[model samples]
Target: MPDLEPHRRELHVHCYRMLASYEEAEDAVQETFLKAWRGWDKFDGDNLFRAWLYRIATNVCLDMIRRTSRQVVTMNSFAEVPWLQPFPDRMLPSDEEPDAVVVNRETIELAFIATMQLLPARQRAAFIARDVLDWSAKETASLLDISVAAANSALQRARATMQEKLPERRSEWTSAELSDEERDLLARFIDAHERCDAAAAIAAAAQDIRVTMPPAPMCFNGLDQLAPLLERAFGPDRDGDWKLVPTVANRMPCSASYLRRPGDTVFRVFKMDVLRVADGKIAEITTFGPSATLKAFDLPQTL
Candidate 1:
């Protein structure tokens, strides 16, 4: 029996991109494996195993997708997708070369994932199959059970939609790994929070920064608007102290913040901030979860 474990992570990531929700993607992968197991006798064993598994996974996602609305997501803000979740960079398939790293980074960025919501499910599948996965038109057509011309057409539309929806800063999406500049900025952000210096934290952000805590209707845009919020967050005599551990998510910098109350012995996981850094500034911050279960990220239990 062929072990499906090796393809599990990438399949989860693929499904995450397809479904735009971490939890659902996880289930999709498990289901994918279960289906693969039941159908193992039919597998030719001569064809590419990864491709065969992806075909099944993609079909599963598309079937699930057909049950949902294909509304062209003209989201006024990212807050609309409460289901949107972070993808940890550490979990990405390891690649040593800089160029290869960047290629992986582009497809998994928050912007890319969010914008992809706009396309019809079939078109999204076709586009991702051909462009992101580097599948040939014939391969994509076969995967989606469509003609090659239709697959190419879908791919073109997806590319156009992505180009229109993505921010201008898309060009700066390259960083084989965190550069010195990104680390310094992350350090300042961590220091500001840990030291309870609201001003310093606010200063590290871009003027047109955006903060979104998903599943919350609130999103603060611009420093002038968001400054007061950070002020209270780092306010003096705040109930407890914050400790930040650097982590990476969605191929960008992030921090997992733990809170220790005045008399508490252990620091508990409180929330996470997934950062979108560009031009040496924190352009976007998406924070959610007092996530205690972080074995997925290999994070410490308490500090």
Candidate 2:
């Protein structure tokens, strides 16, 4: 048997991009491998093995999407995607794999993932294969088990939707790593959160910053809305004191927060806030529960 383990990480990234849920993507990759193993004899020796695996993975994601009740009409905000989850930066393929699809910061960012949920399953698959993976039209068609024309059409529609829905700034789609300014801002964010200084934290954020806690369907837009929430969170009556650990997710800066509640001696895992920085200020924050795989972030469950 071929060494399937070598392809696991990249395949996991692919499935992650397709499903936008870390747990579901992990499941899809496992299902893909199982299906590939069972159907190994059917795979042609002349064909690309990686592509074959991807086809299986894409189909698995499509089926998973079909089974879900979630629907995206117009994704005005990440709040609309209650199922959206963050991908750990450490789990991504290393830079040594120059050809890895996860190298593209734009494709793996939380905003991109949320916007992609707006696409239909096959269109999502087609877009990822053709655009992010740089597969040829015919190859994408073969992977999706569709005709070349249909694949091309799906790709076009997907492109149009992405173009219409994605952020308007050109720099937002670049492959660059987080800049020094972003790192500085992240440090300030962590400091403010840890100190429970609502004023300091709000000062670091943009005036029109947006905060959303996914799987909750709530959005706090602008400083006016976010201010009171921060005050309440940092208030004496708050459930706990916060301790934030600096981390990266989806190629963006993040803070893995732990809470030492009243009467509790140890701080336990709480939630993660992934920041989207713009113009040297924190523009958006997507908060996900600690349900994420913390080992990937090298984070201890308690402190």
Candidate 3:
């Protein structure tokens, strides 16, 4: 039982990959632990505890996917999966995780997770086992209860899907934890939003920046398209005073934004804006509502 404690974070991450929703993944991990405890007598101790626990976690996620619609997989963009959530870097498995379960940066990146959500469940499982976890074909097959050939076939299909869905800048992906340049840009972005300064906001962004808010079909792809949107957000016609607190999500620099209406005394959380900086400019922004996991961040309810 004590041995299982060390592997909890890794198991949670594996389940997270299987289920795109962060909260759902947590639920699945809890269930996995429960199942493991109830079936302890069935284990002969021949197989490693980590491997056994992962099998339980994977099956739990698979069952959940079987019950729910995989419609998010068929969607063209991540915004279509309104329930998609970020995993805080602080919650990830420690670097001390053994080589077999080491959680690599590229595999845990938000972009990587977003694209993984678009793959079929079995393919996603096969891909993670083979590529991300470095499991052998026989091991993956044994865990999935499939023939080795079938596991290889599924992995090949998953790889093709990944290449198609993932962005082209593989070289730049997860290049650093938080580079100095990105930090400067993030500071400017926070200042711009707090001041509601459209010019400053636009200045911090790339010429063709991309922005998307989940649960909304709104995706502004370029500066020309975003100009009016920025005006509406920051212009005098806006209804509130804004404040932003620096934060991090999905290993990217972000800000938790709050708004105070004309008569209100305290600032209330509005949303979280996660930024992607490239070459000294803001390349993309993904904004998420705070209602789902605001408490996870331990932020104050009022100013």
Candidate 4:
């Protein structure tokens, strides 16, 4: 179990990348542990425990994916189909005491995960394991039960695809340690949302802020566009009572928005929006995990 402790955080992250749902990631970790315990006798001391455990987790994720082809509701999906669920922050790990690993918003940002959804499953695993996690090609191959050459090829393909889709930096700019100003900005953002003040919310965002809603393709950019977006969100059509429940994903602070309904005793969990802030301005927004994942963060569906 001592060996397991070191890898638990990473296992959660890896599984989240594979399954793209925090609750599923937790379940995958538990499932991996059970499998590991049962197969402990067969374990070889020669292998790296982190890498070995990752293999089990990856396989578990793959099996789950095979069973359910998780769909991304994009702008396209929203236009063509019905109801696209927002990934809630309540489903992510708590932001207050995140894992020690470097916490960059992009690491678990819903936008990044949505981009990952575009790749083939094996390519997704290979890219995340080798490039994101810094595993070697040989190690990645061993984990995926593929040849080293195949892993290399998959990694290259994954890199190419990711580069095309996401041009953001590969390294993180922030860690568990956040700047005082950043923290203050997050507090203000939370306050603005709670107050349902569109002007205050817009003021907190950067001029070039961008928002993306996934399993749907609709993306809105710039303050000009975002102002109206917020206006509609907090405008006359609905009650303005909302709450922002703090959570974490990929090491950045996030909020699960809850809407109060008429005659309802508590605020009902609505959507999870993960933010990437740079220089006190919002850079990106990702809505990934469905409401079902909220339980992972100890968030109630209705609060």
Ranking by TM-score: 2, 3, 1, 4
- Quality of model 2 by C-alpha lDDT: 0.87
Candidates 1 and 4 compared: the better one by lDDT is 1
Ordered by lDDT, highest first, the candidates read 2, 3, 1, 4
- In model 2, the Cα lDDT at residue 136 comes to 98
Model 4 lDDT-worst window of ten: 75-84
For candidate 2, the C-alpha RMSD (Å) to the true structure equals 1.5
Off by over 4 Å in 2: 170-173
Which of the predicted structures, 2 or 3, would earn the higher lDDT when compared with the native? 2
lDDT of 1 by residue, 195-237 (tens): 9988788789999999888767678899988877776677765
Question: Which 10 successive residues of model 1 have the least lDDT summed?
Answer: 95-104
lDDT of 4 by residue, 1-303 (tens): 435655566677777777666567778899999999888888889876656777899999888877877544332222221222333333333444433244355556554665676667888899988867777888889889999999999999988877877646645543544456666777877898887788888888888887776556566778887877777678877654788877765556678788886677788888777677776787766655446656656678777
Predictions: Cα RMSD each? 2.7, 1.5, 1.9, 4.7
Per-residue lDDT tens digits for candidate 3, residues 4-105, read: 667777777888888777788989988998999899999868897777888889889888888885536465555777767777666777666663365555
- What does candidate 2's lDDT look like per residue over 85-124, in tens digits? 8988888888677345556788888878888889999999
Off by over 4 Å in 3: 71-75, 97-100
Best by lDDT: 2
Off by over 4 Å in 1: 68-72, 96-103
The per-model lDDT (C-alpha) reads: 0.80, 0.87, 0.81, 0.69
Model 2 lowest lDDT segment of ten: 95-104
